[model samples]
Target: DARRTPPAETEALLTEEGLGAEFVPARLGGRLTRADLLARALRPVFRRDVALGFGHGIISLFAAGAVWAQGDARQRQEMAGLLLGGGRATILHHELAHANAILRHEFTARQSPDGYRVGGRKDVIINARRAGLQVVYARTEPARGPRSHSVLLLDPARQDTAHLRHLPRVETSGMRGALFSGLEFTDCPVPADALVGSPGDGVGLALRAFQVNRSLICGVVTAAAGTVLHSAVRAATEDRAGPVARRWHKPLAGVFADLLACDAMATVVLRALSLLPASAHVLAAAVKYVVPDLLRENLEELATVLGARGHDHASPEYGALDKLVRDLPVAGLGHAGSASCQAVLVPQLRGLAERSWFVEQEPPPQLFAPRAELPDLDYSLLGIAGGGDFMAASLVASADRTAALRGPGAHLGALAGAFATELRTLREQCRRIPPGAAALNDPAVVRLSDRYARVAGAAAVLGTWEGQDGTDPFLTDPAWAVLALTRTGQRLNIPVPQLPDGVQDTVLGELLRRHREGRSCDLDALAYTP
Candidate 1:
């Protein structure tokens, strides 16, 4: 359906409503000053249509984020003008097979008297055919390392088309309607000013850009899962025979808690992009790796609630479920998939374990506050490794405080303590092992990375609960907190004894209540009308 209409058409409608400004920096005459706010503004679009969201806007954001983070004055102003005009822009970095591994990139921009001539090809690029500006990562020299590559802003409108050609659209299973194409450049010349940042800064800029891209993508995909939860809950609530509702109540409640826990992870990570940019790389990777895996599993479970209706295209409202299930995974693939994200973590575990994982510093309250004001995103501060994780450290401290208290919160506190203990054990093991790139590919390291992600999720949810100021009933309640921690523990294969009686009933009742009231099951403060 997305392919049936031109992406530019839908993009223009969103642009008319100022969606383009959502990706532009506030200083650049745009609305996007904070990552959390950007997610909030785009939530409705992603919820309604993933393809349109990607084709019309998000892919451009990926291209623009790099410039916003590393671009010179001229580059930023140029990008602002292009996006404000509703013109699509995209980043061409790694081939699909490479998954943003810059070392493997074959595209090159050789120096010339006139300027630089770009050569090679880029495929699986969204909006490539229509994008007015393509921010390309090309090898500028024969040398290796971070300095060898340079980022260039290619303006198709200004280029000589004598050798530049747009590759035919490539059809795919999901996001079928977006313009997924390639660009082949044969000595396409451009002015030297097209280079973004300085030569040799491209790799650093890209690594920093990944932190932003991975964080935003995690938030968008999580919102899509929120849409799925809404639809499933609607089906359960409107079940005519009452049997479906009864059968799905407990499962729905468990999944709802999982979504909340996952939402908390994404929420904290996005906020961290601003509050803790120096240490946000690992946190962002944890979010990218963990959140989508949870969503994929949750969607599969949701299929039971939708029954046969999930596959029935005739039921337009609910049938979008099939498309969403197909499309959500696509967002996880482009820049980095789960394996690549985990690969980033495996090597950093040693340093994090030694210095930061269980430290006692209190995270900024803004990280827990949804849509809270944040400091400017400084891309230069973002690193390959954050050296420490304040979220995990804070989680351990908060759980200790709760576990020390006498009362109903103690049980949940103990679960938190158990999670913290597991993390400590993981750190001990990771510290003793060789922290190398080769270790990242090891199965043992992969499993440990997975456990590390679950630990991060538990930490984020507990951190959110501890920071709540009692205004939100569901979030403030220990019941959901207990369920959230318990579910995360279950994911780690930790022992979770049978829940106390009425736990399921109470949680399920709240889930159905939220659904009936048209409220988001995630940490989002807004309610869903449909």
Candidate 2:
């Protein structure tokens, strides 16, 4: 109804509500101590409106992430104050051809007697026109090398008006309210203080920030999918005993299981950001590459139940589903695409295979808890390389525990044994890959990365189920777990037996129960008015 209203006002409202503090560091008088907690708070906004969510503060968080990772104490303090004061920020890191490939960046910040003369154009930056501060990654050296690039924190207000320009907003199929525009800087002078970290550390800092951004993307995608799923359920159950409700039993139940699995992956990865910072980067990429894909698939399945209401903007109550479908795909292309994230995991596969992946000890149970208090995110501890896969190891451990079950849990035990065999297959495939940077582009390598991601997601689901410790009645049951594993196995192309009839009925029943109660199918346990 208010599509004509710009995102600027909505952003201001969120700021007035003190959401800006959520992006600032706790040391700077904010509550950004944990990524998962912040994600929980932001999920509702993304669920409501994708454009407003990104335009409001997610763009600022992207800019703040880089500064938080590489900026000095003074720089971090200044950014925190700016955000705390309700000012917006944006990051300029990609151009037309080299979108997010920092190594091939054409932007330059040449040294001058005054400071640095920045010249380059950044395309499709979110909140470009309204941002008070812009974090730009530019090459400081004439030579072509990774060390040549550096990050600069520029105050657009201070730039020369004659040399700085913001291109017109780029219209899109969705999220049209965003101020998407290109930024052109021609010999724009920036002070020495604008430089973030050392001249050669820009790429490293950006990669570290990607770890945080990717995991956050998983959370937002899960939330958006949850909103759509809720609408689908309402549409299906509006006539509780009608054919629509009866016809969607199995399909809707399967979709709910996929939602839960994706949520589990998002939760584990977000918690890993604080628990195992070094390994978190690899896991983050896997979460980024896998969870969005799963959510996309789940949304497509829900569309069958939703029918025309998914595309019709005139429908009361469920019209927002149309916009969400358009907005979710953009998350896949932003910051890093699926292929790029998979590339991040390729080079490290061999090491993970031989050293610690499937053989490692189980990760702490708290890592899978949806409402657990996590430690503060330490940017310095985020590393590009990973030595182990704790989540996958947890799956291996759970399979052993389930194998000893005697009663109804025996069904889950059989499924776990099958998944363990799949893990062994993943291990052998990883071992066959020759370790080298040149092999990153191999089709086989890409396929392996994709499979590895599904395996990781399966492990996350297993860990979450076990982590509940029979406290949550719904999660402790093995029916949903069986469905989650089956869905994962389907994605991995691993042949698993059909779900038992009893398990199927139980899983389907839970799906209907959650829908009628106005609760999300994801692990967050959030309740909303349907």
Candidate 3:
């Protein structure tokens, strides 16, 4: 884009390509890439403008797919022309009130055999007013479980116009100008064909979408973070001539460490991405789990160097940094919050869960990983088990999704049972940890271990089916809620109730026991060298 098109030409390119109806796939007139390239290209765009970059870049995914997924080829072609000829934008069916999943809130078409009116509102919908197309994910409780909800693509011109009001400024601390809108679909009419896929398949389809969204998020976050690191290092260096040089090396070291950490994370994300469909849910969740907090740490650290002026919009040099940091949260929180990403990740811990399906049991580690090595793993685990019960719940989620438990009621039941067992196992393990062996002294280890125990404890305190139907909630994403609790306890490392001494026998303990003592160790022991 930088080579052929002038910087100012971006908007014009959108017009030329008839991108207003972008969410439409090539089958519907838009030129979209396969998943891998799409994920990579998004990185640069995120640096420029997270919201718009995400909005325009993904319109094809959201808007186009919503319609093309549901409509017959002819219907898609007809809509395609309208877009190519220029003047159609599609409404992406996302309920900000929900986890951008398939649970819809408005139901105008249920009673009507072929025609329906959509009522209720969709908040934080991108391109709600501007698009000619609206792919709405209305909540239709279809017998519960995975496929309970469905996507319905609407041409707003045909829906109720009275309630179509643009949302207020509503600026967030992060993700500015993302063009978020609230749509009150009051009695909005919808022809039967507007539905994406089979009548009751919306939520399932959205699950696939979520997977894609998660992977794409990693790419974007990776690129933007790289920019931050580059800038920070430059700022730390360029003053070589100054007498303050004696202290300069320390700052350079921090910058270097941050850079190395970022590089390692980038490699981790790629390895995860390469794992693909089989690994998508967990690996993408892991990257989404760690990257944002990384940026937050770097940004906070960089700010100290730039001083109080880093926060000042008045300083041209620092303003960009401020904006990037402010925008950091969106990427950080979006692909599932860091916590949710972690929760999803807990069950996928390389060996712990692998034992359930594999022929061999993974060997328990004798020596622990170095401090830097622990962050991502622990963050992923800690976020998952906020109170200690997360692992149990994760076990449940795993069991519920298993082949034996695919039926809605059956899955929920299995999930519940597994969750119960998970809590028990963790509690027993927590009890085994010796006293004063660990602490939240390190963010990474605490997040993964001790905090996980706490989350397990909390889950015991709160049953899985306590308040809402396990299958009915979109906000059911187990991130933030779990993260807060897990992060707290992760650092604490106290054992949960039962089995042992109510202490957490952590990786940190093994690491310290060997490394600090200068004892010989295995392959993992060698990786911790500073």
Candidate 4:
């Protein structure tokens, strides 16, 4: 069962729903438009099954994103037509070990008079055997720099089968419902027009494409974590006198707050793709780096709350948690791992430390407003590095506003002030990291990047709470924000004061209310039918 694809009926249902159109842009004869909305639309599928979510069409989306981002008019139109017709597409990179950091491409594409001869093997590709379209990363030049690689769009159905071989499917511990396989190209020739972007723009195109994919992925995976938390809460309520149940109150509230925090960051980052493209890459990397770790920790805690039932795969009630626990790690390491994300932030921290942190203007409130209308996603605007630390600036701005509040909400001001101070401390540490040592190989730089990511996450929570338009009572309430920041502070090793009276009870009450009402634990609080 762990080595199989999603059930045939599930695949049929997804196809019937025209889910493949979600990958193609609206202008290109499909329904895809906003990045945040795309993630929201995919949540129901992910909430029920992460494997189904990916195995169905997200792999095609991932492969087609490059085409959408950099493909020529003909290429984009052709790719869009394929996706619109419910055909599958998959991406193939040289190796998974160096995700997004294309150090070298083992898959070679030698130049020919009429076309390029692609030859090499790409392993661990998702949906390799079934996809009709393939987007491959290849070394087009013999040199060893950023401009030596290229991406090629290929149609395997038209290729000569003699030179193209599909390797054996890979068996993995998680997301087994998704196919993972390899492709070996023996002098397979693709037309010269198959090139995406340009001859040496592979690295840039890949990075830009990843910025969108990474942000949306961070938002999508939260549904899985939300499901796990809901299950744990249900189990705890049924057996309140169990050993772990007695102490589940705080942890349950904490996980709920963490989920909200992750959603806040993810929403803002996804919106930034269209609203603030210059800084979106860094924000995306930060969310990608921090959210998974938080969700993984939340899952571990929920597992403990469920006790032995968490591992009981035969129990209809708790069996889903066991599968989710296995799938969350694979999701985290999918497009880019934690270290790769941190590596993105490390080199950019010094620039922000010197000129941006306190100096940059806070991002537009629209960046934090989940329902705000956004401009169309412009792939041309996404930069490799951020302009400044606008999210961090928002933290400082929120602290200033919180200081003006009086009465019970005054404690939140103090919490906000503490995070503002933490940002200042982080800026100094980042300033000290030598420019030459900002690479991932430097442990000190990596640690600094981690700290920066946490601070940025705290900033996102503050911005979201402030951006609420009094429409959602829970989101407008500062109690969850207080708990969210306190949890973040604890992670950063800051000595924080105890929560004010009734704060835990308030958050716990809302958590239970949502469960009893069959609502999701995320910020959306959408009703779910069981």
Over 4 Å off, model 2:
1-9, 95-106, 142-145, 240-244, 333-336, 370-372
Q: Model 4, 55: alpha-carbon shift in Å? A: 1.3
Per-model TM-score versus the true fold = 0.94, 0.93, 0.58, 0.95
* Model 3's TM-score against the true structure: 0.58
Report the C-alpha lDDT of model 3 over 189-253, residue by residue, as the tens digit: 57777666676666555544554555455445545544443444445445555422434433333
Which model, 1 or 4, shows the larger TM-score?
A: 4
Which pairs of residues have clashing backbones in candidate 4?
none
TM-score order of candidates, top first: 4, 1, 2, 3
Please list the C-alpha lDDT of all candidates, in the order they appear: 0.77, 0.77, 0.43, 0.82
| lDDT for residue 330 in candidate 1, whole number 0-100 | 60
Count clashes in each candidate, considering only residues at least 3 apart in sequence or on different chains.
2, 0, 49, 0
Q: What TM-score would you give candidate 1 relative to the actual structure?
A: 0.94
Better of 2 and 3 by TM-score: 2
Model 1 poorest ten-residue lDDT run? 95-104
Write down the TM-score for model 4: 0.95
Clashes of 2: 0
Number of the top-ranking candidate, with lDDT as the measure: 4
Candidates arranged by lDDT, highest first: 4, 2, 1, 3
